[model samples]
Target: MMDSGQNKNETTCAAAMNHRVTCNTFEPEGVPVQVRYAIFCGQSGIAEYEFYLSPTQHGCVDVQLDWLQSAYHQVLQWLNLELASGVFRRFLCSDPHNQAPELEAHAFSNPKHDDPPCAVSWVGQPPLPPAKVVLWAQHIDDPKGIKIKRDGATLMLDRGDLSHHWTTNATGVRKHSSFDQTQCIFEDYEQYLGKHDMTLADHVIRTWFFVRHVDVNYEGLIVSRRELFEKRGLTSKTHYIASTGIEGAPPMDRAKVAMDAYAVGGIDNKQVQYIEALDHLGPTHVYGVTFERATAVSYRDRKHIFISGTASIDPAGNIVHEGDVSKQLDRALENVDALLKQCGASLSDMTGYYAYVRDPSDQGLIRDRFKAILGDVPVAVVVAPVCRPGWLVEIEGRAIIAENNPQFPVF
Candidate 1:
């Protein structure tokens, strides 16, 4: 077993991304498939695995699931770590005439073009090893439907039906419209955190809402979320966390939204601040939405910058570079850089990125452009459309930079 003290590997933690923080990508030897694993060591001496797991084979649903589990276990055993939270992203197929049939296709496979069935965005930790790191997990109605991992303070919750991401994904057994279902999901997150001595309003640092058919369901989600936030003392007049509402299909019959989130409990208010590149982008409230452009959370030794889903928009909330994917992407990145600059960080500090393009044919353009610019950065490009039709693409990501501070706690 590895020592409880800072793992000997810390000596090798390269100062690639920033001082005191190491970042690297390697393929675990034993796994039969490809697993792109990124390791980022915290200044407080914690080993965190930020992994995007996928298989090279674009096959059937069962094959993808089996490979996913196998790849997952191989890494866990190889590193002697435990799984925390996971987001299982699948290629959704739709039948033009039938929602029921499309649901079957989503579960099975699209007959014509079999896309990569599924991939997982998962986080792992070293299991404490009798040290200061505290960890545990929580499951909802269907245990297999969700995966969650958390320390007492930093929580990563993923793929839930109804705390960090109590998604309605596992709550298909309940009959409700998208709006009522969103209400139930948010309530579940709040109550679950309450039982654990945490409150959603205080701890939730970031949230991702994956809506199926974003053009339609996103409205209900926004309405339900805005109302819930108001009740939780999170309003336009007060403050809200960074968030992304994009097109992602939930994994259950009659389900429409899946959620993933990160929260830090018992954190100092002074350590957190909202980022608004007011010169480049407008406040979300300029429309009817409620969320921050980015949120920066500081620990004793590092700072985390959560960039919400950003797109091409002017300070007046008007869409820019409409109908042009390349220009839109450029504008989005410039906006992201502007936001990160406020915290002495930039796009290069991003660990993971998700690019959602409304036009599937533009996938190659998005992929090539990012590859040329970001080089080796972990990016998941999906065919999910943005909430607005005028915008061709939207980007969201997380970035961490090392810092030296006599703060309250380590990240």
Candidate 2:
């Protein structure tokens, strides 16, 4: 599903195989504004889909909902996919123009009939209306191995005791300051994992942190995270869960940070593999940060690859393409491509992605550029600053490569 206006020659396949999960990005024609849509195809057919709409000025709530619904249905029809009753995640950025109210209203109006609860996030100011939205539909068997529960705005999905939890502006036990809130979040996370008989160090794979003012408070978030990790026997020298920290505001006015995480319980080391890009990137902890560049989980039917928030940092830990957004985006994609290859996969296997842009004006250009290169991949673009001021863009994504295919290399 390539964008009609994009150059067909721009697409490339690193490795091609039939009966594998296929991914691509596209932009539909007649849409007044530019929006990037990522489509995914799995064994059971179109397993997931995502829409990344650019920021727009405040508009009528009804009109916005109508447009969104129409666009969503159009994509489903184009791809021959249907909306199934499963989990969907959405992230909407707030601004001075009251984008949250409009988004919330739309969200409430479109309730999940039989679908899983939608985890919503009202973060920092993005240039467009409805900030960003991510929807995923599982088309496989019924929810036999999965269980979902919603507590307030938090949605907890349990895959046979391996739980994934997402919450916005978490109310900490002591929400006095940034550090206190950070501590409170970690404490609660620890307790949540305990219920499933899993500890933080061994089972947690990734975490995302949205700091109100990341440049100033990133250190505090790191300190708190490190302290919690240390308590669970993880250290800079050892393995720490992969994470992303960026500038964004939570829904709560007083809250300074928001968090979401993925963890797996009762899985041995053989089932989970932590990956570090070979010769293309440096260890995140080399500069006092802690995380793997990627993690691969091997299941019976497929291998799931999780790439952390990647930027244009070279193998030696120096920021590449210093001040150029275009070059930085290319470098970032190159880094991600290398990581995917390491796991015996490629960009075509991506399920969905989140692209964070520091400059609002670069949104359209970047979206078009990515579509040209990646070919109809699902990408959610949000106007948010990277943790490092020098970095212009950061991307994180999940990809699944079907197992048992002769062409799909086994890790």
Candidate 3:
């Protein structure tokens, strides 16, 4: 029902993280493919949104699910902001080239895409359209010192001692073993952060596991998340949380495993840090996996970073450009730009990066190699599958630089 209304293919002025937001790019005028996004607006009025939808008018996935439900309710009615978190990348079993089953709101999955980015719509065969699809969403701008809500599948954001979460579809209560349902889903994520008293080795930063047969249940979801992060103290001498188990099929058929988490509460553990170049990769518990290929928090102006689920491997971690998917995506973007230069941030201060493809004909050489060096810096390609198998491709991200540092405070 988007009977025309939406225009603006430019609006740049992102000296963000300290100017409190101003970075946008849209192209809705009749919207026939090619939409970009960006917006930082940090500090008190907290803001974030970065989309990358590229379809090129081959329309009909019901006109790209009505241009993703009219750009998600036109950004909740033109920039009032609401969707606190998101992830939508398609083209697996794809095709919903419509003849009937239409009406998609958050788009993808002729039958769903990502609670991991779709809550209902995860077909196995019978849905159509998808010669290509790309999306990676996120929206926010909850001012008045913030405080947004929604708890059954979670999406919250507060600010007053901090508290931001995005807890999608954390399945598995019982259906037998995939390692005791990932240890009862990490003991219900430490009892949902002990009703807000927080914990999970002090507030998880990022995690997205979706295992259903990830080469046979990713070793029981990595030995039940490393024995529930070594009974909550995350070991290997402490610290581990920043992940992406990969391969998804989550429609919860007795849940083999499904999760999505991003946490935060308060801060200063010295504004958290754990990004390491380690001479370009190695230290995911040296093979047994624990997680943390990237993580940086800081805040007083900026510094975010995230980034897990990278591939290519080397520096002793083995598997480097084996079957060569363009030299394993240039050694997984050179180990994510050397883990964003160990915190000084790089890769042109990424605000978006996502490319997980395990052969969908290597999606046109991963879209001409991320449009020749991330032209407009916002990439989202899907088809997921990289839990190893000589890794064909993988990459995950988030970045926000700036930083003035007045002893932490504005996140």
Candidate 4:
């Protein structure tokens, strides 16, 4: 008897075929499959596929691989059929979450060949036409965080919070920084940025300020930081760089600030364009560029805008809309919306958001407002203080415009 969610037609046919051949014959139509793929940096392509028992049916439910050796031929035939569907250049199939009782497909790599680690499995396949296929054994230490083949030839490790990266094929760690230096500010970085064909003026798109004792005459510190940038030939005034400054105890308990920058030469869209205030509104503090704060960086093909760290402060360096965090938050959201609109996008198009609150207690209040404003968007909320003691909240985001709209690319 087949289960309700099982492939009833396939299973029934297999059963008939089994009876005609031998009662012990193996069958291939007894599993479910899932697939995903992406191309990065216009070069490397990654594809993944998973096979498992159907939700409503049970096949080889309690049997281990050792018991299925006699039926290897049937399993191989099924795998071949999966390959014929033409979705993957590389194939990866396994029991994710290890829900199975015992054994899985053949491990992909052998450690003896100096290949990355792979898992031991009962089924395996070599690279197929159009692309190479390598098997990886799931990382046992962190099943979810690591992927490796038995031979160690194929391996993918998750580096969380360490950095954001695209494809190694296009760029290999092009930008990086560490807080090990005695001073947060680097002198004579020209020799350094030149080595990578980048400079302060090229693509320093975003900035983050983490300093100590930020509440002690913080405005003075902001001016000093800006001067430092100017000394490096990076004029903060007209640079059009997005910035963020916050007070945090770094590796050293002293005042230290770091920056993350982006650079791409010969790119005009990369050139900064300042958004102006409405003709009669003096200067719109709601969206004017400011120092010691993270700014938004956008690409031409992608409608999504990336706003660094935004807080509740108006022009003249006065914290406006305070006391009521929600009011302050509303103002900050408006600022973000303005930037998005400048790029032909809207708040509703946002797909990812990060919220940092100065007080943990404000989470509930913020969540209620977030849901009401965002209406079920993907978001992560954390509690972290702003560089100013009086500031209560800071929020940043990444948004993507809808597909089929000629204006932007799918993020």
Q: Of the candidates shown, which would achieve the greatest lDDT relative to the real structure?
A: 3
lDDT per prediction? 0.61, 0.64, 0.65, 0.37
Point out where model 3 deviates above 4 Å. 1-10, 14-18, 21-25, 28-31, 41-49, 56-131, 135-207, 210-219, 222-224, 231-268, 273-296, 303-404, 407-411
Residues 1-411 of candidate 2 have per-residue lDDT tens digits of: 344544323221111224455444445444433445443333433233455543233445445544555555555555544443234445444452255555556642232222546455445646443434323332222223346667554556655524555554454535766677889988887777777677777777777788887787778887777777777778756787777888777666677777877666665666677788858898887787777889887654467788999999987888899888988989998898899998899887886677888888887778777778876566666787898899998988887776643333222
The candidate with the higher TM-score, 1 or 2, is: 2
Of the candidates numbered 1 and 4, which has the greater lDDT value?
1
Alpha-carbon deviation at 234 in model 2, angstroms: 1.5
**Candidate 4, residues 68-184: lDDT per residue as tens digits?**
222222333432322221210111112212422233243221112213332122111111111112221111111133322211211222223111111100111222222322123
**Per-residue accuracy of model 1 over 285-390 as CA lDDT, tens digit each:** 8799989999998766678889999999989999898788999999999999999999999887876677888887786698778878876566556677889999
Candidate 4 TM-score, true structure as reference: 0.49
- Each candidate structure's TM-score, on Cα atoms with residue i matched to residue i, is 0.74, 0.80, 0.31, 0.49
Q: Provide the lowest-lDDT 10-residue window in model 2.
A: 8-17
Whole-model alpha-carbon lDDT for candidate 2: 0.64
Q: Indicate which candidate wins on TM-score.
A: 2
Per-model root-mean-square deviation over C-alphas: 10.0, 5.2, 20.3, 16.3
Candidate 4 residue-wise lDDT at 108: 21
True-structure RMSD for candidate 3: 20.3
Count residue pairs with overlapping backbones in model 2.
10
Which stretches of model 4 miss by more than 4 angstroms?
A: 1-184, 188-191, 217-221, 251-255, 269-272, 276-300, 315-317, 402-411
lDDT (Cα) of model 3? 0.65
